[model samples]
Target: MKKTYDVIIIGSGGAGMIAAITARKQGKKVLLLEKLPTLGAKLKATGGGKCNLTNTLSSEDFMKSFGKNGRFMSTAINMLNKDDLREFFLSIGVQTDTKDGFRIFPVTHNSSTIIKALEAELNRLEVEILCDTKVERLLFDGESITGVQTQNEKFNSSNVIVATGGLGFPMLGANGDGYEFAKELGHKVTDLYPAMLPIYVKETWVANCTADTIAKAIIRVDLKKAKKLKAVGDLIFTSKGLRGPVILDFSREITPLLEQYEQVPLLINMVKGKNEDEVLQHIKKQTALNPDANVVEIVSTLLPTSVSKELCLIVGAILDKKFKDQSGQVRNDLVKIIVNTPFTVTESIGFKKAMITRGGVTLKEIDPNTMQSKLIKGLYFCGEVMDLDGPCGGYNLQWSFSSGNLAGHLL
Candidate 1:
């Protein structure tokens, strides 16, 4: 739309929108380019369309959850932190509330509300937005970014923010163009994986219990000897494999290991509160009280009937056998299976089902203080394009807004 602008941001996702708003707030001419006709397509689908805006964790705790690369986000996060994010939304006329004491969402409970609010803010700020505009390449002059080029023409700008997101949700227009741009510019892109997707297990029996959820299931992944990765929460059964808060959270760790092992082993603690011995004794006590009851019926009280039946099959226990008729070895085997149900993870459902991308442009190339490129001046990166992914809830959105604002502030 313009021959030159103060800031031209690629991709109209959360980071690009925030960057546009922040740059405009500084009285800079901003033009936002979107690949899709509609803006914020992925943002609209986040948190099942409610748009989890930010989390309620303390700043220190919040950064810790993101792992080592999170330290790079310290300055950006501190500059426009969670409180600032919530306040920004409130200032934009979107009142926010938190569910589960952490995940913050618009009180309206509709993601369109957020998109509307952002659009209104951009309109009020006079930031230009061009939809259905695909940026084919970056127009650079060796060390500094000059602008971006589409098929028909080149839009010139000294400052260009590449917020094209990651390889997650490709159908929503995230085609990894941002990573390609970074690679073309001599920046290193890390190995990418599905960050927050359900894992597919080799056991087909788990698929049959699609209606059942393993509440309070403790999921553990085998690491090197004498070490293991562990997470505790509910695991919801899916037609393909496993899904839920715990499985989604555990997926971050599970994906990297999946790369090396043919089958990543995951052990589930089906009965949460009891140890192997405690659960065995509990079963013995139950059998003593009702010796005539079927083993399936007794175990069903501990787990879902479908799951219990499957577990019995796995442990060589006959569901029709009375509890009193079951041998000690059968009892021990059943207890072991209940305490530690093993599943071999074949792979994740992949980017289509993944809520976020695990890796992107390496952290060292971008200055966290400003989100500007260390190698290429006037070029900035933010959001899922960076080598940063957080746990489920609202951390990723917060990172997007914070990093975008930081870049815009410094721009």
Candidate 2:
């Protein structure tokens, strides 16, 4: 059977929804296809359900968050800049607010609210959405994308937007199908691996002390070229090592080291921004002022009680056995431990457990301006489907919005 549409958008994610809405706004008949039973599966899971729709940082600061590919993302960011997003959300009735560090969330504080708002907007625009339907193949004419073949049937469209996300959580319906689709269309995909994942450490003490512990710490690492690097944020303990915003960010920087050294020794600073000499002097003075106090009690005042006790046992042996017994050297050593406790990042938690798939279809193969393919006309890529990945902020979601919006505008 023959099929027709002014625009066909694959992947009912944030990008897909935004693109569909944009295309519809352009007076184009639009349809969105999804393999999942519902739309916005990953969006529902983002920001722990609060859905950090987009960050509030300036375009310059926003561009810096992408790490290695910050400059390469200029096209998408320039197209759907932060102001565009704030306006879009307000238009869709999602009151947005920004917190510390420019992280933005809905005033309703619920991802469901964000999704519902988008769904309502899409509905109002009369965009057709198809869920639980998979696109079997892309029909291309070497010059442009003509249509797509789905499980139930075939369809034709003048414009096609491939906003399908990457392969992160299979349970959430991210099955690397987007990569397959891109490859099928003769796009070059980089080596796919999981990024923004938890770090696996070999330290038993970290595993035991950190288990179920809501740890807020900074990691200090000596980079190969960047010298000392530190990332500060809340960290979570896993059976193997650590996971959280800080750890995940730092882990990506040391992935190369992990691949080479099998384990990269990291310094976990439960207290960040404090220098070693300052910490030592503080500890020395505290110990001098309260020499008679029990060692655990004295140390507990300086650190988390449990962690302090464990550290006391590790460093206290150099001093006399008595609780309050400690020499200047030992006190200084204790401070050093606190200031720079080193741990190794062995390997990331692997792709299946990653928050978002790291690599995807190379951005060079796709036109940065319109998100259209350099090789395949009428085919556009957006969101995690491209090699573009960003830090833990709202940058990822913003990329989706911008890329989709770019495609929509181009359509």
Q: What do the candidate models score in CA lDDT, each in turn?
A: 0.88, 0.79
TM-score of 2: 0.90
- Give per-residue CA lDDT, model 1, range 71-110, as digits (tens): 8889988888889998999999999998678789999889
**CA-only RMSD, every prediction:** 1.8, 2.8
User: In angstroms, how far off is 400's CA in candidate 2?
Assistant: 1.2
Once fitted onto the true fold, the runs of candidate 1 whose alpha carbons sit more than 4 angstroms away are: 223-227, 288-292
Model 2 residue 4 lDDT score: 95
In candidate 1, position 372 carries an lDDT of: 92
What lDDT score goes with residue 400 in model 1? 92
Question: Which residue pairs collide, candidate 1?
Answer: none
